[model samples]
Target: MHNVSHGLNDIASILSNPILNTDSYKASHYLQYPPEASAMFSYIESRGGRYGRTLFFGLQMLIKEYLCRPITPAMIDQAKAFFTAHGEPFNEAGWRYIVEQFGGYLPVRIRAVPEGSVVPTHNVLVTVECDDPQVFWLASYLETMLLRVWYPITVATQSWHLRQTIRAALEQSSDDLTQLPFKLHDFGARGVSSAESAAIGGAAHLVSFMGSDTVLGVVAANHYYNETMAAFSVPAAEHSTITSWGRERETDAFRNMLAQFGKPGAIVSVVSDSYDLFAALDVWGTELKQAVLDSGGMLVIRPDSGDPQTIVLQTLRALDASFGSTLNGKGRRVLDNVRVIQGDGVNPESIAAILAAMDEAGFAADNIVFGMGGALLQQINRDTQRFAMKCSAIRLGDDWHDVLKDPVTDAGKRSMKGRLTLLRNRHTGEYRTTTLPLEWDERTAESDWDDALVTVFDSGKLLIDVSLTDIRHRAHAHEG
Candidate 1:
């Protein structure tokens, strides 16, 4: 072995130490990445070797594309050798860590109806199968991925539902839905998990709608939009610093902010509630208008305080009264130039109420934009009213076992056991629920079932090359 290092020293070192026992090395690696890897490995280990190879296999498949240059024979050989040389325990631990990072597998061969599909509870929209019996033990670990996947779907669904409701209300209540010009940004990073998940969740939202504050989310969703999306938002900075005498200073925040952002327009969101929302709007309205018009910007003032609905109404009235005549569009003022964007505690429920009040107050619907955070992307709650996950069937020995866990009441969840298949009506284009033996669940056989849940992933490998855009488009189409 050549001593020449190639930026792989750390990995190489871990692999070469003969005295480095598997458990110790595994523990060390766990310390580096922590809980996820260790926890998964520990769980798999608890089941003994039966699950270790399965776990390793799953992780290998999941990260191979990202980690391996091309998953060539040499690369695979190198990986297996490195892992083996590092000792089985460490190798297993590393594999577990990687799998945990990549997410889990789901049993139902699933082709999701896009990210924003308004999936109903008990609707097996996910196509799954016990296709590969060897990976049966993987079902448990797959739960993690399902949970992760479910969050984005749930959040996106809720947002899409709200958008749908908004659209419907506009039509029914004489409000123009077309007034919502800005994007629907998923600005929940400060409170959500890693940047990736936040961005992913944001991308999922884009499937049902558009707008995101996350750059990563833009990239993820942009792959589908076929256009470059940019993240135009404010920096996280305080204008004043605390001093001895309870002092206050402007510190040229507006000027400095102008310097950085310049003449802002195009979804320009400023946090007015930072100090005093109404007062900030009162003070900034003039400059904000000039800045927007001069810079060709539409100032969107984000009031993240008080009751979102009340604040939105007041802000809308203030902007309208102040700049209404100065601007051309009735409620859309182009002169004084400011739009009230409700954020902070703006969840779906609050949004619904806000929209209702704004309509009741005869507020300009077009003048308001939404900057959703916790409510949209935080996976608030499983509003799985129309959606659900159930065990269709469990295979025992050579035969399949059908088990149903019927909920005693609405509080008690129920599941159906045994191999089952979902059928969709071609004429209605809706999912038709039913159960049948897995052996007869083949769609290629020209089954009477028009809608069949096919396996999207098998043995830890994706069965298709569906893009995020595809998911988004499908979700949007389904919503329509």
Candidate 2:
């Protein structure tokens, strides 16, 4: 966290000066897609299905971070001095206009698929346009900031995929599917690159799952999306909490957790692998079973190391054998009062494997949960889903020009052209991107697809302020 604060200060001066942006963007005003380009429309899309195409997240946060702060004269002076010292030419005129006319707020309109929609790959998720002709370059300039949305969007999509995977397993193994929302927990705050990254990426996970240890993510959801207490965590103990009691009194350590939080319905997670996991489980199943059952609260035993699928299956069998089990409506055995959580080596792939194995073992999915750290928030990159933002269309003085990059080297890198509209194929409910005129009206035309993109940001104001609850609801709707 300290590292992040210092890093933010390092770039604070440059970010404050909007003109200190990329050099190629400086020529964008004059040298555009074509000589007559007046308005440039760019869109963001995912080209792969590794994480699915749920996107356009973190827009509100991007707006608040870059657009809300006013560019000041002091910032301009600092930019001028910094650029001149480095023998670089600064866009003085551009910065002046932005400071005077735009009042530091971006003069751009952003249309996006509502956050949490399960969009398909190779479909546009967001479109950006600038109303001011002189600031047509602003569309792509904002891209520099807005493109950061890829991180959160990717994280959200990955988490959503995990949710779908869990839901499917729960449907197969558990009669009660309501616990799906809490199946995957976020333990990635400490594993991410920075505090801001943790907040954004963690909140993205919350869009699908409700379990999280990242308090800043909850704060971010509340601050950016009007959410209140968007995610939750349980009272838990780490290895230190157990080891500090010594191996001789290990049972005392476990007993202390129950004594601290033993109320009915209270849940506390204990990292049971601090010493010998099997030995600890043996003691828990034998010496501590009556105390745990009498306490009325559920105890979540955490296995933090070893092959996740194998360890989880072993833990489930051991727990069920000792704690006893009852068959759910699905005829799958669920633990009587205790559950297992595999926090180690738990990624989307491993999660699927674990669930499948558990199902095959005749154990209910509701008997266990997963805690993911780096894989949940930090392991992925923009290329994981092949996300890209490209200018699809440019309006000349009196004509609209379609623009695209058709690189012969890599066909996969080819981009879409012309004014793009994201539409959902009604029959399949799959999102598709189409090239159409800017003035094309859907009201007067009959089409097989419904427009999926909506105005989210228009000229510095946020048009849509979706709450976290609403987003969760939307993400879950597709499960039906």
Candidate 3:
């Protein structure tokens, strides 16, 4: 191997190393655990936040990307040197032991609810435990990384709730629910913090919809989740493209968009709010009205700056004046070949509000869709679902000790205790978190019938493989 090292004054590696993926404080955690603690049992849960449920996802992506590979001696050395200089303790001997004894595969087992399963919060979403007595700290050590899954889970949950809102509106106003999946589009790639954030959060949104402009998210779903094309986008124009033409020639830019992309039976979106949004609407409502009709493709009008609900109501009325509307079977007006896409300031509340206002105005839900950006991907935090991973139980010699924390200050911060497993009722389908030995050993008859948890990873090997298609099917199963 070529020694491409820059000398001691060298910049730290920007490349991803499993050793450096965590908070620096985590490097000293091995020494902090109980000395006699032979093994740790920890579980992840969403304590409840913006939503009551979470769409558990992105775990397979994490496992395939980080844990499947073996740890290298070089990694240990690099981490040691970095931590020594950074004023933190590094568990060198423990990491070396992992390399020597386990050939670098982390001696831990991970079990989680099957990916794409939407379960209520305050339940076990994932559990981790050390597979070796020597690596008792492995479970918590992985917390800093494992908890990152909350990003995708929360995104998926938000997206799923958006889907429910859209579906309800469609049911009330439209003749069919076929267009529901594409109703909430992902316009969030550039709005997020990182490319990986775009990728994972984008993929999470794809759980409920097929409409997205976030290309890397489509690639991630294809690469990590075995999808051919998990999401899709139509030819659309941004503000830069429309504004590139001088302000006086706004209609010409809108005309050029149609001339370029409006093929028979195709759909295209154009951002119309670069200048005077209503003025642009006036131009489209008259000068380009005949051109839009003759093109034989759908023209999605996007209003980029306004109160989404109010703007949607006004846009629908403007489009109705331009193009005649026919009432659907449900007695709501559906605009012919023209639709509005409200992309500004969209979130769960705004989406529901827009749909409700549409219902009040006798407009069909099919007359509009939403394009969500920051709110869909980057606007949330771990506390959006109040996610936490805590050691609930530990093994010391022959006895298992149950552990828990009930903070008197905040009852919401209280935690559960046990070597835990989640079980579902065969008849009611409600889930319950129960202790292992009592449930798995003594009450095996009941749990064996309906254990909701599945072991997906064991001893650094992925035991069960899942695909995007299967996950999508499971996610949509409850809908019909």
Candidate 2: give the clashing pairs. none
After TM-score superposition, what is the CA distance of residue 247 in candidate 3 from its true location, in Å?
1.9
Name the candidate, 1 or 3, with the larger lDDT value: 3
The candidate that wins on TM-score is 3
Runs in model 3 with CA error above 4 Å? Answer: 1-15, 440-449
Write one digit per residue (lDDT tens) for candidate 2, span 305-421. Answer: 888888998999899889999998999998998999888998888989999999999999998989999998899998888888988877778777788999999999999988888
Q: For residues 365-393, could you state the per-residue lDDT of candidate 3 as single tens digits?
A: 99998999999998999999999999999
- For all predicted structures, in order, the TM-scores are 0.66, 0.92, 0.95
Which is superior by lDDT, 2 or 3? 3
- Model 1: per-residue lDDT, tens digit, 1-480? 222232234564434332121233332332333122211100111111111110000111122222222122222234445545445432343333333533323222444332333333444545344433433423332333343444555555566666776665455443345543243556776667676566656665665555566666666555533445533444432323212212233324543454455455443455555566676666665655555456555566667678777787788877766566232233333324566667668776777788788767665455566777766666453333223444445455555555465756753455544444456555555554455543554673354446445544553465555554555555556432
Q: Cα miss at 156, model 2 (Å)?
A: 0.9
The candidate with the higher TM-score, 1 or 3, is 3
How high is the CA lDDT of each candidate model?
Answer: 0.47, 0.81, 0.88
